[model samples]
Target: MLRSKLTDSPLLKVSRPVSACSRCRSAKVKCDNKLPACTACEKAGREKECTAANDQFARGKERSYVAALELRIEKLERRLGYARSMKDSVALNGPDEPPAGDPNRKDSMAFIRAAIHRKAVQTQEDADINTLVSDFGYLAVNTTTRDFEPSESNMTFARLVLAASTNEPVPTPRTADLPAESTARALVQFYETNVIPIYPVFPGTLLHALVSDLYQQHRRQIRSSEYWLFWMVLAISSASQSRSRRDEHYQHAVEFVGRALPHADRALRPGYGTQVQSLLLLTQYSMLDPAHFDSWHPIGFTCRAVVDQGLHQDPPHIQQMGQDALNERRRTFYCTYALDRAISMVHARAFSFYDEAVCVALPSPFQASSTLSGSTTAKRSPDASLPLFRLRQLQSEWYQALYQGNPNEHLPDITSFIWQKYREMWEWSERLPPDMPAAIREMLELELRYSYVYCIASNARGAQVSAYGKLLIFDHVISYVDRIYDIAKLAENAAVYTYHDALRVLFMGSQFVAVLQEIGDLILSGSSIPSPAPGKVLPPPRPVRLDRGTGDDLDRSVRCLERVKLTLRLYGDRWESALSCLKNFEGLSAEVWKNLTTRQAMRNPAPTGQWLPIPGA
Candidate 1:
């Protein structure tokens, strides 16, 4: 019978047994391993579908499991709701039952009572908000007040903004929590509004009070570099506004900068730090007018001392301190230069002796040392280079100005002084160390050229009366132009050939042409040559050369020639004047650029109807 039943049954043999549902495993219930309809799943009304086995869950039982979980969650939520209602009820009244053995029952009861009081306060706060809205609802206008003074309001606003920006709490009169900037701003505002108006009536007392307030408040609080800069600027403004208060501001500035100098020196990093020092020094210098200062000599001496000290220190030491000693040297040079200029002004009677006396008080170390001690030796010290150069220039200018006229006409004196200084400068140039850098040598040469031209101009007026003087001045002017042309030929760097340098050369050439014209006029006056018609002093005819090689070279040459041409036409219209000046320059230019083909072509004449190339082309 078993064999017959097996033959009638349609069953497939399995290699492995199937797994049961995870839910059944957890519930400890048996499962039927059926492909589509498992016995236990069908009895429970769960669809029997074969799903890929997941290690995390049994197959096809997720939905029923989720439903069962939801029912339990609902029951838990219901219980939580009941518990909360009980808590609210207990809070509204007293505890439903007394604690059996709680030791802190009294404290717990007090805490509950406190909580209830806090809630009552919150309710009152809400009620106040409603009342405020209702009370103010009837007012339709919303406008800011204009009755307040603008300056006072601006200061208040600035203070408030500054406080807010810095995250500092607003200040209260009783708390003394205000920031220094706010206090300073308030003081400044008070002075501007209440004190400045009556400044004419009681300037001294009011100004003193303002200064004191600023010193006590803002000045003390200034710790940053920018703050020091701002303080200096303010001091300058204060000094400018009131002449009587100038000394006070000046003293304040000097002290403030003295203190700030160490910081400024420390702040000098490689690039920007050095620039910062320069700016600070310039600011300090700008504060005192040379004309007004009692003595600039002392300032010069102090500056020289500072520079000497810095230079004496090791580079490593300065580097460690984040300072650029080179820049410090430059600053000292400028200070000395300014002092020398002031002294010249005094000597010339351009400024008062009292003002000049101030400079005399500086220590001898600050003064130019006469002896070539090791420390003062020009060759040994690099710092001495610029100052030495400047001193020479200043001296040359003074003498040149003196030779030009009475050493009293301010402008002429200055010009003559520059010329004398130029002569000395050339003498000094000849003595420069053989090892000097080419750049420095080039600069010295340029300065010498400048002085020479000025010297010629200085002697032009005197040259008009005497044949010897005229001949000497004319020769010197021509020689100076030739010297510049030689230097331009030797310049190997673009910096030496800059447009400004070119312009300077051209200007010197024009001045030479002017002097030549003056000489010609003097000749005309002395000789019995009949004068030409009015406004018709025709320049002497001479061959004109217009072919410069490249556009730029051509342009520069033409520009220089044009200046001579214009000056001759305007002053002496005789073609002879233009011809003489042009011939001299053209000859010098040819000698300088003999190898250049363009230069040779430029020396030749251009075709008719073709204009000369413009300058700076």
Candidate 2:
């Protein structure tokens, strides 16, 4: 009966019905789109005959608002029942909540206020959660995880990594901390010229827009990602050029990092693609500013993001995406891949994931975007990062085979395999585009030599390294140490060299010294060592030196050892960790260094009017 009465009511109308009543349609008159009855029908005294023409219901059985009204009524009825039940519960003497003779609830108004307070606290908690979620820019980060909630404790991924890795707190910036607009632009120019060509994780256009917006337009409207990007670019560019810990560039880099961290909670919020990019930028900055942030921590986070996001593989249904999306995804993944390989190798640690686990293809040809300032990155050749990406892949392949997957077992043809790897890298280096910037080109060349020596030097694998292999290590390490030292001593670094480079120097120098210790005669004798497999592809020939220094074996070896010290000492000025590497290297080679000094001293003889050669030469 209730249903019938509700359906019969002419006022039972929806906000906007789809069609007129049957009578109104038959009469060929305009309809008000009301339900149950048309106004024309009521005026015609035919209200009993009114029915919607296009109702998706049986006759005499439907009301337009039935579901909505019934739901509302049910809710009210439920609340009414609950309110009656709670009437006594809200009282001071309520048996459910108040303890016997509790002084806290002695006053009647106190109990009422207590009930209201309890409800407000719940509502406030929910509001806080919502506000927190919204502040993360909800689209970029998932704040729904219970552990990350404020109700539990104050902890976030950003805080976790920053705390673990940061050795010193970045100084908070003052209003005067910002450099002049032109100075900022020049720094950005440096980053694009040196850093972007190697990583290319983000589009240049977006950075350019952010720089213009920050300087010319209102800064308040800028987004968190924009601010993070801008600040990190400045920080990395400055820190990369810093030759001393006390330099202005280093100080300014720290200041910019401090400014960037406030925006990091949002920028690095996980569960979004931007998370990987943001982490990559942090890794780049951390490489330059290891005192403030550890590159290892950020790169580890980035690799985790890549695996979690399935960026290690090509998209299954790639055609569904736009070309630009596909390229950016691949580019970002490869950038992370490259950094992981480089950092892990530098630290002499295992890679986050092996090459067999990753299948992402190289990104498409680059489409350079012009910065607002109209410089750099734009002039570089497209696909400038591909060479580095390929080299990392090659490094990963052998590093995994030799050091990680099965370090105990020797490969079936280890010698051939080593030479093959060197050949592949040599080809990669030889193909460097002539049009590439000299700075970036030089950086790639350095990486190639490092890889060659790193691969050839048999560290942990059980097989005894042949004399030829040790010779390869000797020559390549010399080339790498010499060039890298020159670059480190420059007033301004042409490329991004970091504390990681210092670590590499230690490793290469150690290898060079170790080879000399074992075979000081054969290596320093200027006599060629035959390949272990005479018929097979010969081991890479000795490095053809451009300047064969006029010295015997002992003199050359001494010079090499001294250059290693000078290089580490120079890098030590920039990174505190490099100083640590220097000390450690000195400790490891104490005996070898002492013997070399004694030998040189006895041979050369004191004050026979024999003066030492210039250190720089």
Candidate 3:
């Protein structure tokens, strides 16, 4: 029913008149609403720059977006300026020919500029990769999934996303706000004596020189990348020492690393040894802060830097080079290799560099007697790291065989494979020097034991057998558990345990508790188990000295798990992973205790001295 009356239609609202000219709007300054140009832009001698806001601009009100765009434009402008300056320099210098007499410095200056240009380009690529993959979208998922289907890639991407999403913004450190000299010195000293001995990757003599120079001069005078590297190293090492200062120092390290990163590309152009050392230190320290965006990413760049420097190759004139430089190159390359292998293991990613392509020598078996400035003397000594690296390399082989290969393909049965690896690891341990320091020996021995337990327990389903066989394996693993606890106790007494060491022990201990809980379940179920081997007969289960576990035994196990939890908490401040591990242990203990308490309640009415009968007896 349309009324034919002359109803007035709503007036078409005119588009809101542009309130501020584009320049004024961008700067968030007031515009006088003047025609042709705003009064603010005219007064600022930018009259031509003022224009009406674009009607199509959808996000004009977003301050952050505008700011980001402005920043990008500034960066482009600065880069343009740099290109112009470089062009001028090239023209003036005329390609940097060697001086007329001595020809040793053949086009050295030209090469330096070229290298700097190359690194700058590479640095841009590194940054771009981060921006491209930071979102962890379908691209990252698809790429990783395609490379490693039904394998670790999906989990790896998930972890990376977890790491990224949970990361909190850290405050940038001001150079003027460094720690007091005395405090800095003490921390550095602790690092040199305690932390450096374990990794032994950084050159002690070179570090001494850097420290001397740093303290002797003003911090402002030494604003180079190497100085920043030293600052970061000091911060991370100090963080490892005390919980009270851990976060503060780690934050400082993070900030310093960020500032030094832009200079990293240019610094490497000099062919100076500090560049490699600094990158290695950063990569190593990054491992501790798992939540950092660049934590694992820097390792890839470090490897590229190493390869660019030809560090993987042993020069034919190695003897002619400074002995210190040569040895440092060797140490740095192996350390990188070790780190690469470890990261691959942790992230389940493929190793960036291959061992077959490596040609660098292993670090000398003996300790460096004096400074690098002095004789690079070689003497016999019990170097624990030599064997440790060997063990790690051996461990890496297992990873390659298991993960790098197709998961669907038939491989060795888990038991036989594990047993073979165990035997090999045991033989490898035998080769370590008998007289090695207890500090080193204990950790290495703990790793071996932990590896055994990890392998057996990880593949427990594959080793399924009758109840008696599970009991025998349980008995064997329990002893290893006891050994781990004993070692942890010793470590508790000693102040030398690093976060990495504690984390390893806690991880293994937690798994051990889990295995025990599983075995307990099997005992209660009274279920028949198939033999691990199809046709082959297993040896009769070994007779154990211990009797069936009673209430008291169950109570003891609970107390042991509680002790492990308490130990993990001791390290919670220095290592965030400790808290996560503690939570896991708590859950496992709660479940195990609940089951035990119920069993105890059922048995309460029976004789106090009676013990639960063994299943499958």
Candidate 4:
């Protein structure tokens, strides 16, 4: 037999809302849909327990999640302020306050009393606030604290993160014999020379220890993290050295990665400190080998791991921890932070967390472990990564200001803001340590140019960019494309170049095409650009001699565009996803490429029509 039950309360005798509170629904009873607490719950002494999931959803999701969180926090603060005021009033007037364990203290917050004569009466809003405040403690999860053993649960945080981020699954590893001891040593040496200088995520000695444990003794039980560290170093070193996917170096990289995957579940076990290191190693390899894993995902996961375990915050005091361990922790956080900023900027996405969220200080330079005597700290580490980390901080500030800021919210005096950012980055470039490695210095220089163009162009709500601003963008992008093209042409990577470099080239090329499309004639006319009238801040001088000796500006533009394409093509040789960059840029600028070619041949070309006008230009 079929039966029907009423969805709302008939016993209330008045109009009823469509749904029942959680307490009523569980007891199969009618509920009058009073907010904060239902009538049935109140009658049953369960008013504090009343909840409606739908109401929470409808109200909580009405605006942006971040905005909503902010609003709720503000409301909570106001309530706390009111509570403080009430306590102050009591101290001044001697009004009796609720004692500890007062029945009302458990059921609701007290101090609604104003003075000795006024009686306390808690409103529904107070109850509502009390219930909502409890929600603040909702998410108390630590990825490193949970142990999902094979017997307990099939899922692990690492698998969950990989499941989301993996574009192409890492290939199943072969159970082949390990590489010769010398071969393994060479890969480690290359990594120390090229990669470790910029990303000292782990101490140099750890990799060596893992190697000795694995290659020489083969007697000790190795942890999952040890296996991950050894293989990922081999993979990243091999892949970075590989110029072509079909090369022997690339083949060995793929093989090493296959060997590493078996341990990822354990290595990436979520509630442990080792997970961050493992994720970091994977992130580095992903940057080099985008065909198997997207660099973006692993870095995001790594940042979350760092933040979850409070690694983003510096220690309270030196006496609480060893100096080496504290420095390593800080270095680890900054490396993840740097990667997050760089990746987000290249992709034009929001950072996992803003610069305001990170409190860790820059770490001391970490020198590679001395191989001669198996002792590290032979010479103070060259401060290469420190500069890179600083640049990311600078980049994050302006990138968030110019690009990530609200599109509808106007930035006051945007021109001065951009110029100021440009100047700060330039000064940073000038102050780079004299002994910084050539390749590392070159990367930072490229980053500087990228920042200059990025900040000058206002794609969001900002002031109109004058012709001088467009000229600034044109000059910087021309310099950027020229340098990246040279780097791409090298037979092997000097520093750790990755697919993101290709993306950076593509970004710079787009700006190059944009300026040429908007103000091609004036730029090519080689007319001197007037700098903004000096205010409290000064505009950067027009790029000196960078564009002077070039061919006709149109010719330079075409060369820059083609060089951008070619650079991506070269990067594509090592990382397949870089070819996607090549493809995307080719599609986007094909028309501009053709137009520049067509217009370059003419002795005098008239203004081209129908280009998307630059937002503020």
Candidate 3 — which pairs collide?
A: none
Query: Which clashing pairs does model 4 show?
Result: 143-270, 143-271, 144-270, 144-271, 144-272, 145-271, 465-616
lDDT of 4 by residue, 1-617 (tens): 00001111112111112245667777887554555576677777988888753443343333232333356768767876675567576633334544333545533333333432233323434444544433322322235444344344555555655654565666766666778887887777777767777888876666766777787654588787788788889998888878888999888898999898878888887667788888888888887776777666677667767765778778777689988888988888888888888877877866766666568888877655322221222344366888899889988888877776667666777777777888889899899988665667777787888888877885666567888889988888888888778877965344467878778888888787788778877777878778768876788887774656767777788788879888888888777777877898888887777776766546554467745433112
Q: Write the per-residue lDDT of candidate 1 for residues 1-617, one digit (tens) a residue.
A: 32222222312111012334444555556544443444556677765442212223323322322233345556556655665565565554433434334536766664565456445544554444333323221221111111111232332211211111121121222222322554334333332322122111112243335445545634454333444333333333333222222345444434433333333322321123233333333323332322222222233223323332332223443345433334434334444444444333323222111111122111112211121211212221122244343544454344434442343344533333333454455557667657544444555555554554444344423432334333333434444444444444432332222222333444566554454445544432344333222222221111122333534433333444444334323222211223344455555444222323344356665688887553223
lDDT tens digits, residues 1-617, model 2?
Answer: 32222222212111112345667667888765333455688788877888754342344543332233344446556655565466556644443465445556556565665567556544554444333322221111222222332234345556644654465678878654456889788887777666776789887666766777788745658767678888889888888777789999888888888888888766766565567888888899888877676666677767766765778788899899888998889999999989988988887877766665577888877744223122543553656788889889889888877887555454777767778888888888888777665666777888888888888887567657888888877778777877887877764444457778888889989998889889977765668788665535567776787447547767767777788899999988888778888998888777777777777766666685777643223
Candidate numbers, best TM-score first, in rank order: 4, 2, 3, 1
Model 2 regions more than 4 Å off: 1-153, 176-179, 217-220, 367-378, 408-410, 535-537, 606-617
Which portions of model 4 miss their true places by more than 4 Å? 1-141, 368-381, 408-410, 546-550, 604-617
Error of 3 at 335 (Å): 1.2
Per-residue CA lDDT of model 3 for 523-600, tens digit only, reads 445454444453222333343534355335454454455567666776565567668777776775676656665665
TM-scores of all predicted structures: 0.28, 0.72, 0.58, 0.72
Worst 10 residues of 3 by lDDT: 6-15
Quote the lDDT for 321 in model 2.
86
**Candidate 4 accuracy as lDDT:** 0.70
Error of 2 at 80 (Å): 48
